[model samples]
Target: MVMIDMRDIQLDEDESEDQYEKLLRRAKTEDLTEISGIGCLYQCGVDRLGRPVIVFIGKWFPATKINLEKALLYVIHLMDPIVNGDYVIVYFHTLTSNNNYPSFTWLREVYNILPYKYKKHLKHFYVVHPTFWTKMMTWWFTTFMAPAIKEKVHNFPGIEYLYPDIPPQQLEIPAYITEYDMTINGIRYFEPDQSQNLLS
Candidate 1:
């Protein structure tokens, strides 16, 4: 089932400002943009497309009842392209390391709002939804959902899954799923409602 243990995962060493610039530069695109919920929109300097970018990380934006809904609507609005069969890259960052913070359920809600084609076109549902705080559910996803999703992506986009930063924090892991790995970058900070657009 292609299992990867969280305990075995290790984030790459910290990157310097120059290296960070290189990574960002490499990620730039005249046809693509990345939205992040990790911080303010100012950090996102590129807006080659119509809108800057719509990053949907639960941690970066305010999750208050009103704010969360606003964010969701904003996400839904921006996701229209994905809804229309256009390629849209959604890079999500969970606010908390635990399974609780910024629920993936919300993502499902976002999914439900999508038109059936887009919803059906979703080839992969890569996530870090593992058991407790250990695995990335790679095996569980493959054994159970992957096959179904594989067939679905034929009409739907093929599913591409990710466990990005597993065992989000420092923690030991079970042996069977011991291939989990992640590369941490930048100083972890918490700031809410302070981010805005940067492409203006």
Candidate 2:
């Protein structure tokens, strides 16, 4: 019988821990002014379940103009604190043209590097106004690379559907998203009073 060396396995584990520590250090120190200025990602408050809500406005993300590494670091920085506990993500796919979408390779790389702990604590991932491409890509990625998160992903046609899971009062939904929802749904799911209050 072949015997495995315990020393080699211990060394590998140590290296992995060191790499994660280095990543955390970079995430803390990185200057991400430009990325933050884009208004792509932010903590919007807590959901009805009291889980922290992280919102991602896909239309605002300038995938082509920004450095992917810095963008990744910024995402890590934003998520680091909250990932320690239960959290939910609201990704607005409205008005996300081809230019705004990042490369699949970049996404895959980000997914591969993220620790299991980060994935474990994410209770839900709500995609608002997801396009066909968005659905297809999400399916492909979840099916092959990240099966663990597949069940957590939910798609809603408009903002109103999100209210049942995440309270409308908690989220600072952008005017553009509301307008688009109105344009497509042809009925005001969000009342005028609610719109004014959220926009204010």
Candidate 3:
């Protein structure tokens, strides 16, 4: 677990600011948004198809309930202004081949409680560089999604493959994802004959 130091949190210097402002400033300073691989939504710009781009990190987020809830609320708050009744938000989700992954139950809860207006704006969902494990997890999750949402989901083998659908310039690819070396951990897929070779 990561330890947070109260002393590290910065408070606003202006005494005239209201209590809400001070509290909000503290929240921003103390939140887990800085964690690597935590789910974050940033508006990059419009894609070639004119859909607004919203980037999301899928792994490395804190698994604890309190942290997860705070992250979800933060994402929704940032996304609200960018989405409108007619706007379509293009979600670009970065998937890690190995390492951390967000909890399924937590993700389900986050999606289930989203306002219809927010959900309706999600027109496309792209999973970047899906690995064998990601494919299996995605398949399991799809069973719970509405048909409309399912239809919007697609997978890209690599960054080059995403160019045709979502212009490469609009995306803010993380350095870790860009420099991913699949060869080191590439052969982890399930093979009945080589079941013992699976990654633990």
Candidate 4:
């Protein structure tokens, strides 16, 4: 039998508590006006299965202009309450230019720092209008680093595919995403009147 250092364990526990407190402070105090204005992340509503639906609009995120640390804090603030139960993420990748994408290192760091509780209750991760790069990057990351969530990740070429799992009526989808979907897929996911209204 080996001897365990109680002092070391206590120090680690204290460090974790301190870190959590710091994150809570930052989440409460950080100025996330720009991020909020762009509407990069929000809870649209609940899915058919009664899971909370968290939407992340990729095109709205200005990675270069925004402070990533504050953005991460804002994410924690928005998600902390929702993650306690089962939820699903709908990532709209429509019209996402290269500049909108965050750095791989930053993405990795955010993933690493996120508490396991956040990862545990995520039932599904839907990527709508996924590009080639998005698919490849997700494949690489999930396969190499996060194998547990690999099966939970689903890629959709258009919003129509997502409608089966999450009805269009349930989500407050951005108009631009629907327009882009129509442009590429040559089809509308919403009803005729709804599609017309979205375009109007």
Candidate 5:
């Protein structure tokens, strides 16, 4: 029989989650403002599917790829205590387009270099509001991913479609996503005359 460390497991799941959350709330980066753009928000609860959800905004990424990677890694490290079991990463790339999007090469490199433990528990990857170029880029880049990884990807053209899978309140849907969704549905407060203003 194999030996196991009972101390490694926390009996009180809520207490463990609370501890992880405290760390995340206290987590600081070199650039505080940038944290809003690329940092993880709340982690107290799971998604609608009962899996831990890590929410990240794609457009908030720094222009420098290295900085972006570092910020993300730092955030993940802070949440390391709770990022086990079946976790689902809900990425809001609604505002990300070719102009601001990272190079496909960098994306491919990140995927190839992801740690095994990180890859194992990733149950789902939900990409919301994918642009035309985003779709094209994903199609091309996914060619390099294994079938299992590829199956985890799910694209959302509209937030309405995403609600069934992930509740709005559960994910704490960002204002920008809600705004974008409103614009998509011909509901916008600004420039009322231009009813069809959609963010790219």
Candidate 6:
């Protein structure tokens, strides 16, 4: 695993993501490929997908506010060919105690500032909501909420939903995925969204 730094992820809020990434790459060019992790740092204004190309992962879970505008700006910048395939790992900056979790307030606040195209990316999010649910909350929203959201997103134009649950081991996945995440692993293969009630 490469050792990426916190700065790599906290791109400038004013600079375009490409410029920021360009600077980052130029600065860490020799060691870019070697970095295995990074830490909390938020940037703003990105691609149409709102997916931040830069990811920050830390030993402790992320508990910091993820400047959703910044984060979504990143994601929007990453859509297109990137979203077509591959799953990027996300480590929500989890903090030590009581106050831990994405700052939804900040997220909502910054969300409006997103570029029209960036906002468009989230529009297709309905297709990936289940995975988003699994990734973000580590809980099966389908089981709790109506699978309607999942189905709705699946219907979005140009969106492809892959790995309904877990594909056979032979299938190639971008990252190592466990049937259930060890710490925050969801109840996969159990109480699937199809169950009558999530409690089952």
C-alpha-based local distance difference test score of model 6: 0.32
Instruction: Itemize residue pairs with steric clashes in candidate 4.
Output: none
Best by TM-score: 2
RMSD of 5: 10.7
After TM-score superposition, the amount by which residue 8's alpha carbon in candidate 3 deviates from its true location, in angstroms, is 48
lDDT of 5 by residue, 1-200 (tens): 98866666444444555554554454543444455545444453576668777776776655455355555446555456555567777777777644456666666554544444456777777777787766676666666564456767778766555455555577676688788878876543233223332211
Cα lDDT of all candidates, in order? 0.32, 0.84, 0.55, 0.81, 0.60, 0.32
Q: Candidate 3, which segments miss by more than 4 Å at Cα?
A: 1-39, 64-66, 85-99, 181-200
Q: Per-residue CA lDDT of candidate 1, range 1-200, in tens? A: 89976555422212233343343343342222223332422212212323222223323444432344444444443444443442322234332344324455664454434344544444333232223332233344334544434332211011112112111222222222222222222233212222321111
Best by lDDT: 2
**Model 2 regions more than 4 Å off:** 1-17, 188-200
What is the per-residue lDDT of model 2 for residues 1-200, given as tens digits with 9 covering 90 to 100? 99999999788767766766788899898788988888889999787678889999999988888898889888888898889998999999999898898998888878767777778998888899998888999999899988999988888888877776677799997899989998999775654344322210
Error of 4 at 115 (Å): 0.7
TM-score-wise, the better of 2 and 4 is 2
Worst 10 residues of 3 by lDDT: 191-200
Indicate whether candidate 1 or candidate 4 has the larger TM-score: 4
On a 0 to 100 scale, what is the lDDT of residue 15 in model 5? 55
How well does model 5 score by local distance difference test? 0.60
Please identify model 1 stretches exceeding 4 Å from their true place: 1-55, 64-66, 86-100, 103-108, 125-200
Candidate 5 has a TM-score of 0.65
Candidate 3 similarity to native, TM-score: 0.62
Off by over 4 Å in 4: 1-18, 188-200
- By TM-score: ranked, best first: 2, 4, 5, 3, 1, 6
True-structure lDDT of candidate 3: 0.55
> Which of candidates 4 and 6 reaches a greater lDDT?
4
